[model samples]
Target chain A: MFITSIGYYIPDGRITNSDITEILVEDNKEHFSKEDIEFLTYSCTRKFEFLGIETRSCCSEENGDHFASMAEKAARKAIDQAGIPPEEIDCLIFSGVTNPFREPSFAIMLAHRLGIKTGDFFDINDTCNGFMKSIDVAGLYLKSEKYRHILVATCESPYDLKNTLKLDIHIENTDQIDNRLSGLIVGTGAAAMILSSDGGKGRITHYGEQRTSNDWDASMLTLPGTAVPGAKYGDTITGFWSDGRLISSSLIREMPEFILRKLSEWGLDAQSIDLFIHHQLGNNVTFALMDKLNADHQKAPVNTFKQFGNMATVNIPVNLAIADEQGLIKKGDSILLLSSSCGLSYALLHIVW
Target chain B: MTFDEFKLMVSDGLGIDDTLLNRDLSFRDDLGIDSLSVINFLVKIEHKFKFKFDVEHIWAMKNLGEIYDTFTEALNNK
Candidate 1:
């Protein structure tokens, strides 16, 4: 199976770190340290301008159409670059943490927008690791010889109030600096990639996963839309609290070793890989993972944390597209994509360019 | 800092118009500055002032006045 094309999009609005900090001070007066602001600012994936809406354009509650619109733009670009027609697509997948509606998969909406009716479309909610999982599933379908072309799209407007609510809570409780600091670096964005069986541009070599559960810690980071009973009420009614540092500590402890083991299984060392495209969770986690894998810092894809922030699922593909645009990857380069999600799911994929 | 000096710093840092710098304008709102712009400004600030402002502190600043104040404070402290 070949990885044909990739595309990404971010909303027009821009929100700086200072913008968020100014808003946070209205609810909580506690002063945040420079480290705290850097971590939190880096966590946001998008910077939305004031559009006179309840939430910014990047927020989940702003509009479902925006997500669909951006997803369609990226999908169209990817298909065009791959030199494939929309109707030729056999399968389409939309995976991410933020979805416009609970019912009717976003993939179906994307497929409709792209005018691709001859394909099977679905959505995946694997959070950070969704893209890698979708790649594995698409690869299997490609190997079946029944499908000729597949489109995998992942989008997350993490800046949305629905999604940002979790981040907002973590940021508001700045006095609990340790926990809030950890979750503050993930930003919001969207990405799409086309997969084909006809030997296109890029190819997937191997995919692996390692899972560990911290069910007790599952409540550490809860989105506002969750069905958790007590949380059904408003934020004032039910005190919003999450220990992000606790979650990151667990992830940091488990992920590096898991990724290293997966790479070793393929008999490939860090030096063999040309680029490392991680989840874009944060600068800290990225550096920590690099140190563990003994990977060179220069070889890693540009981390948008300092710019766009953490964009959850869109992080990987956005970086990939930017690298591609900058000619960062050559014909035979090996790219390693890894992600660890909230369910304690860790996934890794090796791509041969 | 003098207005001319501030305009030079922001222009050299953000690659935007030096004339855009108004004493009353808010950087976060009026100028529509984002994180990337903030980072670019920080890099230039470090080079020009020979000091690094705390990124988190910089992240917490809202307007141009606040940024100017922070930079001055950092320079003074340095």
Candidate 2:
């Protein structure tokens, strides 16, 4: 699939590590000692410092930027960039990691809101890798000579998930720090990409996927808390399930093999890879993967994780924008995307920019 | 919990092999255990022994013996 246009929506609300330190101080001042407060700040900030995430953006309830609204805003940008009305959109796919509603698919709601009455509208629930995977699927339809303009959108709201009444039960102390710190590291993001077979500036040509479920419950984006027990949301998990240590260790051990396998399949090597866009789980995971692959991610755009946290499905386009913003992307640059999720699903895509 | 048992959990959580389970194991230099790994490891230790040591005091620990001493003191006080 060739990329005709790319647009992204990052919430205006900014949450920094210091902001989290303030939040913890406000929420637990009465329960914690001065020493505890100092410890909490160090404990939280030290982790982010190590992970290389300084700030992130999330949906601002005060600003009225909910997940669906942000999705529409991003989709509009891509549609506008393509210089085509929503009616011309052959396929509208919503690849959201944090769904806003249950009954009606987020894609339908977004399509309706954008005044897109007719199209093959659906949702691809692939956790964080949905956007790129959806692009791979779109190529199949485009190759068969059916779809002309395939538009994929992603909207994630970790802030909204954290505020849910279900996940908001009181926590007695800092033992829950891992979950809470993970929450701090998460922010919402959305992006829209218009793809076509017209051979535009970008074309994704190769794809690979794998699942290693040995440590399935070891890391996740959501916690099975009091709000709902026994409930499951595989594609759209609430909050960020971060087994930072486990993910760091596992990705280091396995990602090199995955990268080499996919690259070899495409008759390429790590040196031939121009850019390896990765899931911004954190700085630690991304660097570990790159280091193991023996690839220099120095010029590769990765501001989304440090600046906007993990955007889930929107990570690829958003990170691409980060690359474009840095002038890292140019015509004819070889590109690749790598992603991993809690299901332990891993995907790699070879594209040209 | 015995010192050996506590050391074993740290080594396991960090994916450190048994040969590296010496008393002077440095978290950063030897194990490459970042802050998050240490937090997860400490949480696991808390679950096993049912005691929450002050993470602030223990995070700066440089060796396995100091880590064991920290937990030993926490259990003793309890």
lDDT of each candidate versus the true structure? 0.67, 0.74
Model 1: which docking level applies?
Answer: incorrect
Instruction: State the weakest 10-residue window (summed lDDT) of model 1 chain A.
Output: A45-54
Tell me each candidate's RMSD, in Å, in order. 12.4, 6.8
Model 2: residues with Cα > 4 Å off, grouped in runs: A22-38, A61-63, A169-176, A220-241, B1-35, B38-78
Error of 1 at A290 (Å): 1.4
User: For every model in order, what is the number of clashing pairs?
Assistant: 21, 3
> Residues A232-324, candidate 2, lDDT per residue (tens digit)?
324444444455556655666666798898899889898877877888876556765666678886745565787888777888888887687
| Cα RMSD of predicted structure 1 | 12.4
Task: Output the number of the DockQ-best candidate.
Answer: 2
lDDT of 1 by residue, B1-78 (tens): 766788787877667698878667765446645333455446545655667666446544667777788777877799
Give lDDT for model 2.
0.74
Q: What is the overall TM-score of model 1 with all chains considered together?
A: 0.69
